[model samples]
Target: MKAIWGQKMAKVPISWMVLLFMCFWAYMADAEYVKYKDSKQPLNVRIKDLMSQMTLEEKIGQMVQIDRQFASAKVMKKYFIGSIFSGGGSAPAQRASAETWINMVNDFQKGSLSTRLGIPMIYGIDAVHGHNTVYKATIFPHYVGLGATRDPTLVKRIGAATALEVRATGISYVFAPCIAVCRDPRWGRCYESYSEDPKIVQAMTEIISGLQEKKSQLVLNTMWAMVEQPKVSMRTTR
Candidate 1:
């Protein structure tokens, strides 16, 4: 009698069982939100709730940022990736439009939203000079050229323009307004610095205010301002 009963149960079709399981899971997900998922809760309460629920693997995944070219929705969904970036060489497919970029971001976002905690991913790119990488973006003068102008107001306006162009392409973060003070003209990357004089670099920081119209991001280098001394004394008995 037991053998006959097992045979009958097995004949019920596996697809039907899978369909029922999926439906039950969907219903449960839609039925309620824990405190962390509730928008009305205080931020601290939500943070504590979310942190308590995160597993070690999930926390690690959140701290890692995969390059966009190497990532896809399946990877994001599986790993719960928290961030992605497009480097200087990475670009969308040929002749890709603003819509294409938006769609790409949205697809990755959907993957993240489907995770257990539904954390969104931050997308980034280098925006040193007016969204330089995006197709047809307005390219502004580099820091060296801008420095020569000696007009903080002009640099500020450039920063504002850069922010708008970057946002239009669905990117929020910018690596811009390099604040390094370069004293030597021969340094290969001195162009990134605004000026050799500390005062000039200080004044040009007005760009920060303009970029802050949306949100200005800065790169902080723990470098000290020092002058190289002359190897030989210049004194000859006067």
Candidate 2:
């Protein structure tokens, strides 16, 4: 009778342990189903919920755009960088492959998403003419040449092709379609100008529509003179 009683006492604790574990698991499952993670919610509602949960440092991090040379997984996580960019001639190597570019961008993305908020970082590059930074990408004619052709359809096709090449390397934004009216041939970047005439510039804006399919924003370079000095502002506001 003593031996049977001891065995029953041991079984009581085991049953209690199992029940406690199940209760704990139920709580965790409920916690994981947060409103911010629900896709059915409206975008604004989702954004509001996310913003409400983020710390001030995290909100400030989203405003900064870091260059690839200075970017790292640790830095991205620590600062919560919102975007990464590759300037002209800033490829991983002299002729980095498309796969290499994609992998590099993905690594940065992983770092960004590893933070507490898990927000994805936007990747950008100077893919003005094809994926100019990557090897084996199609090298299209310059905007000046394309403008001279006077074919909006061909220009639009080029823009679409450029967007594809940029995406192949995992970049989501492009610095392209430089809409500058070059009044002087001596300017260093005069070749980037589509034409001296405003009409040509207006017509070539169709490229904006082609590039918009990928949710990519066009980097417009507009030079306006001030009374005292020439201020060169690289505006991506549009």
lDDT of every predicted structure (CA atoms):
0.74, 0.76
Tens digits of per-residue lDDT for model 1, 1-238: 9999999999999999999999999999887758887889999999999999999989999999888898788999999898888767577776567778888888888889999888888887777667777787788888888888999999888878877776776766555556667877786778777789877877777776666574544221112243211321222110
Off by over 4 Å in 2: 1-26, 184-187, 214-238
Segments in model 1 whose C-alpha atoms lie over 4 Å from true places: 1-31, 184-187, 214-238
Candidate 2 per-residue lDDT, tens place, 9-97, comes to 87787779889999999999998876787899998889999999999899999999888999988889999999887878888877888
Query: Against the true structure, whose lDDT is highest?
Result: 2
State TM-scores per candidate: 0.73, 0.77
**Candidate 1 lDDT (Cα, 0 to 1):** 0.74
TM-score of 1: 0.73
Which residue window of length 10 is worst by lDDT in model 1? 229-238
Highest TM-score among the candidates is held by which one? 2
